[model samples]
Target: MRTLCSSTLIGEALLIMFAGLVAMKLTDVGTGTIWAVSGVAILLCVLLCGAITRPGAVWVGWALQLGVLASGLVLPTMYAFGVVFGALWWCSVHYGRKIDEFKAQRAAAEQAAPAAA
Candidate 1:
């Protein structure tokens, strides 16, 4: 589940960045800089999510995510989007732990069952 959550967060980040870029281009809002910056931020979130998710990288990922959220404030829409992304990050963190626990239990059960047989 942690892996799934990580993938989901990464997917969301990519989707948001792509959508924002496309919208800015189509609307000609002259906010190219905004979109570009957001895209980079989201990309960083993707990396952070992946990193922290792997046990030892948690602090780094958390810090980077916070930075991304803070930087998103320049645009209200981006800020909202950042909040959603942050939620994903939280879910990934918590869910990943639970998933790891379940996997460990399942592995233990499997090993025990074979021995019992």
Candidate 2:
């Protein structure tokens, strides 16, 4: 879960930066505002990497995703990017748990084999 979520967040951070640059170039939004928004999004991604094991971190991640989507108000392209990343986030959580489950099962089987031997 941590690995998957962290990887997804790293990707999201990059996308947010890209969107910020685009917004700065194409929109009337102030450079300072773009910088602040991008900075906060990137910072959240870093914090989320460490907080993956913490309670309610997933909710924070979802909020960040919504923030990314909201940026579409400034840069319409971000809506597509946000949706794509959101799906990726979902996949990361879903498949990551499945992988963890498989690993646990394998470990249990190994332990049971040795015990039976």
Candidate 3:
């Protein structure tokens, strides 16, 4: 879960930076406002990577997803980016959990096998 989630977040950070560049060119908002938002969001992504396994971290990721989606208001291109990354987030969480469970199950089975021998 950590690995998958972190990967998604790191990718998001890059996307957000790229979107910031687009916003700078295409929007009326001050460069400061654009970069500030982008900077905070990028920071959140990096920070979230470390805390991915912690309690409530996934919820924060969900909130960040929504925030990214909202970035569409600043630049329409972000709507597509937001959705794509959102799906990536969901897949990472979903499949990562399954992978973790499988690993645990395998470890238990292996342990039990030795005991049975």
- Model 1 worst lDDT window (10 residues): 68-77
lDDT of 1 at 39: 69
True-structure lDDT of candidate 2: 0.90
**Which runs of model 1 end up more than 4 angstroms from their true locations?**
19-53
Ranking by TM-score: 3, 2, 1
Better of 1 and 2 by TM-score: 2
Query: Each model's TM-score, in the order given?
Result: 0.64, 0.94, 0.97
lDDT of 3 by residue, 28-89 (tens): 99999999999999999999999999999999999999999999998988989899999999
lDDT of 1: 0.65
Better of 1 and 2 by lDDT: 2
Local accuracy of candidate 1 as per-residue lDDT tens digits, 2-113? 4756675677667567756655665545686757766675777577555654665666555655655665444345566657766776787788888889899999999999
| Tens digits of per-residue lDDT for model 2, 23-107 | 8889998999999989999999988999987889988988988988888888999899889988888888889888989999999
Question: In candidate 1, how many Å is residue 109 off?
Answer: 1.0
Candidate 3 — what's its lDDT? 0.96
For each candidate, how many residue pairs have backbone atoms clashing (under 3 Å)? 1, 0, 0
